[model samples]
Target: MNGSMTDTKPDTKPHSPVLIGLAVMLVAFNLRPAITSVGPLLTGIVAETGLSATGAAALTTLPVLCLGLGGALGPAAIRRLGVDAGILAGIAAVLVGLLLRGFGGLPALFAGAAVAGLGIGLAGVLLPALVKRDFSRQAGRATGLYTMALCVGAGAGTGLTVPFEHALGQGWAAALALWSLPALVAVFAWAPFAKARPAAAASVARRPAPSLWREPLAWQVAGFMGLQSSLAYIQFGWLPAVLQGRGLDALDAGYLAAVAAIAQAPGALLLPTAAARARDQRGWIVGGLAAMVAAFLTLAFGPEILTVPAAIVLGFASGGCFGLGLTVIVLRARDAAGAGALSAMAQGFGYALASLGPFGFGLAHQATGGWGLPALLFSAIAVAGAICGLGAGRAQQVGQAARGP
Candidate 1:
């Protein structure tokens, strides 16, 4: 549990922290668009492809499942590619997957989603480690910035894809494909760091950290991560469709989703910093979960006039929840290696658990022929997430004394 394996040596002429932060944000920007873009366009994809409800659910679920699988690969990627190269590789995969999804037929679309999910999984898991490694002094703030960028990206993907589709005159595929451009930019921005050697590489090689798989706190963190993520991905994959079913036009629903997503930016930016400064994050976690549940209820049954406000509230609350969830990972770990390991466990198991939310929502809607069941389901998830957060929000480091055999 010592910090030797995670400490970086002071660089004689170090890269500016601001520049590194910018690079991290840029990479983070590419993470959500691949999945978010699909939600706003789901109706069209289902219509054009003649997909059944189940098939469409699978379309959204596949990438999220891949995210978990990819997260499981993060430690291996760090060992083989180093953090920088690992990120570069992840972005490249995203770019390719976006392109493939945009241009191909049904089979190609699913294939592309899997590829992109893998990339997202890999990059998502590694980014926290990079933040822990380079920004240990300001991990909370740094997590906020990147998490904000991620929210912005999610907003853009939801907001802009519709506009892009209309402008391109081709369809949803073209709009989805356009997301690859950001991935291309991220790859270039991150390439310089790919070759830079991490100072702790030697230390990491000499000492293996304890396994976190059996740690109760690690499981608590992972549960918090997965359950919150279940809500988040449900929003990403279904909120717009839910709005459309409420009689809004596709464009309006998409914009509302964008508003919710963009609203998260400020919350993502501010909450983690506040939580990090607090004695414990439990209050923040409970408040965020409460807000999210309220927003979900409002969106599900509130008046039409209240829709925008609900979206904004949902976005802000969800952003806070997500940013704090990630902040806990860093706060709970003793070092960068531990952060990487905890992140992988949380995201790997967490996202896999998350994929069920959207799929289950689709199934619930299909089974009941109403949003009531789905609304109840959302409430159940938020309540469960809160329980896990209460445990994870404690001031303690994981894997220090509770390592798995």
Candidate 2:
């Protein structure tokens, strides 16, 4: 493993662990809503904006694309600004994006999503490193907590957007804009913790992160991140729409999506903690992929009675897979700088690759005019994720791949 970070002083200072932990949870909570909320509201947005199905897909695709692009900038920002400042900036961007989205118009909607996605990307990479740095002794548990927060946030976004729209007398823009409240709260909530960590910025700046782009294991991890993320984003962007095509109305479709999303919370809370204590995470990875495949298959051809249960299974597996991906980033790194680099590398390339999932689903649907084709494609994605996740889930670190016999 890279040893360059050893010289930096440890951060055991002004901020209590509770404050930092709360900040992490709040920030994690902000990452998904700005993006996930759009999916449930897509039908309304498309109707009002007159966007084609593919163009509407861009509402989801653009942010995900920005997520990859923005993640690439995280390490550099942290290198210059420190973790706290970097995160603060990220939260600010999210707030700004939400405001832009809420303001109205299609251009504003896309632009806002892009901006928020950039913020999410920056925040995403930093959170893992923060956990690795501050809660090293309980990285798994801490990660699980924050991961659960992420799920809850995503679940709320999926489940609540329709209701929010209804409550606002079917005001889609109003609903989309209101999600800013939580992100605004996150910014204030993160401030005290950021203020307490002035020294951490200096320490992190002193460490030179190694180049991970050349490492094969790093690519494996990136592949795992990308593949699983593709599935998750698909769920985020298209699951409701897919279900709606089956005969459900907007609210019923939203509820089904919510059930799937909320189901993820348990696995997000438990799997990473369990995986961290294990000798290897391969079994969890495989199990999660298996569940995704099953979910897809059921959605594709099973009886309607099985669909809801399958969605629950898919959510549970997805949460475990995603949580494990976050855990591996920390577990495979030797220090915060290393974790930051790995997180950037994984999320950067990974999300860039994943951004295509939603758009592709849209294209497949547009082409075949049904969910059958896309469901098969989703199964294919699950198989690919399993292969990559199996490698990423191994009991090894990224830098160690170079030194191995």
Candidate 3:
């Protein structure tokens, strides 16, 4: 077994673990909204500033791309600062980026987004490992809550942005910047992590992270993550635009995107819980991923009438895949460190590579001048996710695949 993931005996002894769990969920809930909230509002910002199509796309693509790079570095950052402190730093980074964007114009918009992505990406990787460390016996349940919270954050970001903008009479920039408030709240809410004495967490650092990148299962997991993520990021980045391509207005496009965004919460809560109860994750992995494929197929082949339900199914199914994928990383590993390593390996490359989905879809739209065929591009990516997820879902320890030199 991977040294880092060695499962400890569950402590049945009572303690109020729910408070800590809630705090962690709150943190999870804030992770994605800032990143996703901007996507639906992209056109408004672009139109006001006269940003090019490439510039508008970069706002979305850059954050996800940086998520990949930041995932690789998160493990090291947590080791240096402790999980709580690392999260605080990440929160602060995102806030700064948010403020930059609020200041208006192109330079701040792109530069701030890249910086904020780095912060979100780091926090994103750190959270799951921390969950395993804190709630060992209930990794599945904890991950379910965490993933659910994440979906809620995503949905809120997509669902609320335009309304928030209009309500405050602040325009999209000011409304977009308001998302940073949650980051600040997250930083304060996690102050307990900073209180962890140095000696208290010394054990976490000494037990070296497992060699996850070298493991075949690790690669398989990362591949599933990236492949499905390519589909997801495309939705976050282009679904509204794709809908608009179908003869919908901008407001109509945003509402359609909202349907997909809101669907994620239930999937995040349900699928991972189911996967955890099973003997092998392969069935859940294959089946849940297939649901994602079906969602895309409905969109591709069906007429406009199918748009609403298709978005909902696609959103829920993808969130389920994410929750299941993350659970597989935690359950298949032996400990917190193993979970951390898996998180890093899977998300780092997964998201970086996944950024191509939106880029390709946008490029295809530009090249082909329509969304009809470009939507098919994502359908193909979903099929690839199924293959990768099935392999990673096997009940094998990531550490069992290799030896130390």
lDDT rank, highest first?
A: 1, 2, 3
- Evaluated at residue 169, the lDDT of candidate 2 is 78
TM-score of each: 0.95, 0.95, 0.92
lDDT of 3 by residue, 1-405 (tens): 001223222332222456556767777777787677887788788788887777666677888898888787877876787665776677777778877888777787787778888887887787777767776677777788888888888888887888888898978878888888887787777666545433324445556888765688889889988887788788787777767666777777777787888798889888888888887688887777677767776665578788788889988988888888788878767877788888888989898988888878777777777766776787778778888887888767787645421
- Residue runs of model 2 more than 4 Å from their true location after superposition: 1-13
- Per-residue accuracy of model 2 over 129-178 as CA lDDT, tens digit each: 87777777787888888998888888899999889888987478889888
**lDDT string, candidate 1, 96-190, tens digits:** 99999887578888999999999999999988887777777788899999999999999999999999999999887888899999899999998
TM-score of candidate 3 relative to the true fold: 0.92
On a 0 to 100 scale, what is the lDDT of residue 373 in model 3? 70
> What lDDT does the true structure give each of the candidates?
0.87, 0.84, 0.76
Which stretches in model 1 have alpha-carbon errors above 4 Å? 1-13, 198-207, 400-405
Candidate 1, residue 17: the lDDT equals: 69
**TM-score of predicted model 2?**
0.95
**Model 1, C-alpha of 84: deviation from truth (Å):** 1.6
